[model samples]
Target: MRWFIFIAIYILVDIYAFQAIRTLTKNPWIYSIYVFLSLAVLAALIYQVSTLGAGKVLDIKSMYVFGIFLTVFVPKLLIVVFMFGEDIARFFVGIFMKVAGSDEAQFMASRRKFVSTIALGIAAIPFASLLYGMIQGKYNYKVLKYSLEFDDLPEEFDGFTLTQLSDVHSGSFDNREKVEYAVNLINEQQSDVILFTGDLVNNLAEEMDDWKQLFSSLKAPNGVFSILGNHDYGDYVKWDSAAAQAENLRKLKNIQNEMGWNLLLNENRFIEKNGQKIAVVGVENWGLNGFKQAGDINKACEGISNSDFKILLSHDPSHWQAQVKDSPRNFQLTLSGHTHGMQFGIEIPGIIKWSPIKYRYKNWAGIYEEFGRYINVNRGFGFLGYPGRIGIWPEITVIKLKRKKPQT
Candidate 1:
């Protein structure tokens, strides 16, 4: 039923867009070529979908297939929308002419060539942008640094640098050398501790099999601590059985352990410096509305005191908004990355940072402060669904902790 609806929508939009193209170019040869190309693209899309079936895992081939579909269909959809608007206006104009008893034929205008040209011109923008995103934007890794000051920060831990990488989604990576380079970049930061807020794989645990050694190289004096993201639970894919899904999660935990990462599951670990201690609490993936809610902040902070400076690692920023911000225990800082900024957005430091994901998530990207608490939602370290990123490139966040000096 879903596929039927999708096909119906696609065919309607394609027909509309082809009509607009026909208006722009009346040459028979040009129209023939356009029709042939459209058919070829449609055939390829059908073949890809049929081969993948309903349980698509989104491997490299699947990524390319989806990318091709987006590149071809998105622009056509836009063109169809514009053409539909023009048709509606024309219909209303004809109705008004008939009601006013005027010569409708005199005022009636056919679909203008200029309108078609304009539609094509506007559609080209996203087509070009998406192509660029698939080719170069996904691998364009950027390091974002922040210095956060807090009155409650322990003096001994002042200037403590922490590096965070989130949403690795190892299943989506097609290049090894590029990933290795990213690993080297993380190591160069020389952070006191490395934190990974999750989405290590798209679904299955095997996605990280080849990348384990590469990620194992990530090191810090205080060690790497990680928490599971929504994808790690195998919730998005179909499983053979409940046991099989449970086993997949168990293996993922084992893989994290093998990589020397402390996979904190609704628990807390302390990082001590010069006898001053700060708690690093981690919770399983917890999100709002339809997403899994396995994270328990209260349980994770069980033994810790409010006086002890604390940082919480939760995958979704919504968790911070839903529970952490107004919790009885004040969590000074939280790190998250489930948004991925929709893997597309315009982010110009200090000027503007915007993504459509904001409409769905309040704290979609970067540092958000509420009630004196801070949550840094890392834009993610890898690409997923669309196979690439646009203005919102992959991110590696480095946070420097500072102790605020008392005013005299």
Candidate 2:
């Protein structure tokens, strides 16, 4: 709903901006016609994308319109992309330069154009890379990864290995070869346990049948444990009857079992080896917003003692943010996915990694530790929209947990 409004306004603003640029240029009439027609072409194409089933024709039309924008619209866009950055930089630098030292003020004043260019380029670069990645399969991979390291741990269980995969969205995958490769990657890890945090299929459990045999190939020394992601509930699919949704969820549960995973739903189990015990707990999706269902964390932790080392698998990182981070149960680690880093991001020194998702989960990816608790959010193993990833690669994380040795 918000997206629809944004696109509508974006097209409108694009038309107005292009027309205003045309008024400033040579052959104004010609440019105006081109701008108006390009926008119309774009609008019609976007409408079809919303209503039509995805296929070759729609794809071809989309590329055609995009190519038109990239080529023809570049001029109009640059007309401002070139101008807007300078204006903003100058406005900001001028105000700051007075209070700032002479050299400092001049330096800021000098970099306005650079800053502006960089600001515009930041957005333009990722979006353009996303489009180009579609052609090269540069952003397409069936893996998600994050590493876990524990400090001040038990010597025996410290460096315990766990691998996490999440949001596979098997429905979004088309490359069987890639699926096999992902499975092989998981199997290759010298892991004691493998955890899949959820979204094994998009919305249809049937989507997993073709890939189930492939996924069944993954093995760890201990076992694979999984919990439901939001998509696994089958809410995104249209149902002829409520029974169909129920049936799909049933199939999803069975699919998890068939894949040889311990499906932990608001439950707990203990992994004991060599005189050490670690509790593994999982809960159904209890996101922060409308998606938040009633997943009882206390119930999941019921039988487990607080002194035992514990790991948790919850779907949304936000759930950890809301509940798990400060819970009294003493879970040492929590694994989650569902952010996918927008399946797009910017990378350099400190990446500006954000999707609309950041507004939801501040610790959307990598490692987040606060107040003696930790969470690792996987970027995701599958593509969602535009069928690709850019900057953020799919991950296959191997985390090592080590116990602190006794002081001499």
TM-score of each: 0.92, 0.75
Q: Which runs of model 2 end up more than 4 angstroms from their true locations?
A: 1-127, 136-155, 349-356, 406-408
Q: Write down the lDDT that model 2 would get.
A: 0.72
User: Number of the top candidate by lDDT?
Assistant: 1
Candidate 1 residue spans exceeding 4 A from truth: 88-111
Backbone clash pairs in model 2 (N, Cα, C under 3 Å; residues 3+ apart or in different chains), count: 16
Error of 1 at 229 (Å): 0.9
Per-residue C-alpha lDDT of model 2 across residues 1-408, encoded as one tens digit per residue: 965885675666466445334434468677768567766856765765666443212233444455444433444355455455565766776678666744555565446445444544554654466466554443255343444555545556766888888888887766677668777878888689999998887778888888888888788888899999888887765577899789989988998898898999999888887776788899988887678575779888888887777889998988887888887777789999988877666645364655665776698878889877888888888756556666766777678786545568
lDDT, each prediction: 0.91, 0.72
Clashes (backbone N, CA, C under 3 Å), per candidate, total 0, 16
Q: After superposition, how far is residue 1 of candidate 2 from its true place, in Å?
A: 13
